[model samples]
Target chain A: AQTVTQSQPEMSVQEAETVTLSCTYDTSESNYYLFWYKQPPSRQMILVIRQEAYKQQNATENRFSVNFQKAAKSFSLKISDSQLGDTAMYFCAFPSGGSNYKLTFGKGTLLTVNP
Target chain B: DAGITQSPRYKITETGRQVTLMCHQTWSHSYMFWYRQDLGHGLRLIYYSAAADITDKGEVPDGYVVSRSKTENFPLTLESATRSQTSVYFCASSEAQMNTEAFFGQGTRLTVV
Candidate 1:
């Protein structure tokens, strides 16, 4: 079974500052995909960024980036220049192995950007 | 308008009653999934379908039923609703490939009293 864990339940960051959300997973698969999703007050789930396990280089999408450590099974998200709009619940997810491709997610980290 | 959608954004039902949540996608993706979001549980997969008639149980599928008669629709049903089942439900779809990203709907907030 694959399980994702987000150790931080809640986090806060100041405007223009940077914040990093920690995430770890237990997976035996050698190659896979990891994703971060943001859910705001509108109840819409938005994709933040993604990282492939086989690639050693980190994935960066504008201000959103991921530090994926395959050997340790650690995938953490870093948000640079945090803005008020970045305040939301962030989830880390990965598809399970097999044909179903079911996504297993972490508990999520509630992030608040204070002005 | 060419994305996934979930009907009855908010629903209230009595215990032991049956309620079905509808999901539809226009992309004709090969995989559809149902997930429940709770305060400390993020999103737990209840059911998922690989194709029109290929459905499988997920981590938490005890009191839920799902059907995928069509390629674009996957509906989740609760035969006997309970207060414990009150949570935000999300519907998502993805391509057949393993590394593709999953597109999510706005989610349905279901309350069982």
Candidate 2:
């Protein structure tokens, strides 16, 4: 069983500032995928970024990037130059490498960008 | 244009009543999943199907039943809706390929009173 943990329940960042949301997971599987999803006020889940366990290099998508430390079992999401639109509930998720396609998500970190 | 959609965006039902949430995806992904989102519990998987008629249990499968009769449709039913079952439900689908990203629906907010 894989479990994702987001220690921070809520976070706030000033506009144009950078913010990092921490995430850690426990999984025995060597091959897996880590993802960060954002749910805005519309309640639509959107993919932010994703990182594969095998890839040593971190994944970056525009302003969103991930610091994936496979050895430490840590995958953190960094939002650079945060904007108001970045204010949402961020979740860290993992998908097993095998036939299991279901995602194991963290409790989520509610991010608020103050102007 | 409709990638994925969940019917009855908001639903209200009484306890012990039977309620079904419908999910449909146009992407024709091979994998479909049902998950419940609560305040404290982010998203707990209820059930997932790899292909049509191939279903499997997830972390939280109690009190929920799922069926995938077609490749694009996966419906979740609460046999006897309880107050505990009141939460937002999200349906997602993904390709069978490993490490592929999963697409999510807008989600259905269900209230069991």
What TM-score, over all chains together, does every model reach?
A: 0.98, 0.97
Lowest lDDT 10-residue stretch of candidate 2 chain B = B94-103
lDDT (tens digit, per residue) of candidate 1 on A57-81: 9999999999898988999999999
Best by lDDT: 1
- Report each candidate's C-alpha RMSD, comma-separated, in the order given: 0.9, 1.0
**Model 1 DockQ vs. reference:** 0.76
How high a TM-score does candidate 1 get? 0.98
Task: Give the true-contact fraction for every prediction, in order.
Answer: 0.71, 0.71
Assess the local accuracy of residue B108 in candidate 2 as a C-alpha lDDT between 0 and 100. Answer: 96
Tell me the tens digit of each residue's lDDT in model 2 across B1-113.
Answer: 86999998999999999999999999999999999999978999999999999999998999999999999999999999999998999999999765688899999999999
TM-score of chain A of each: 0.98, 0.97
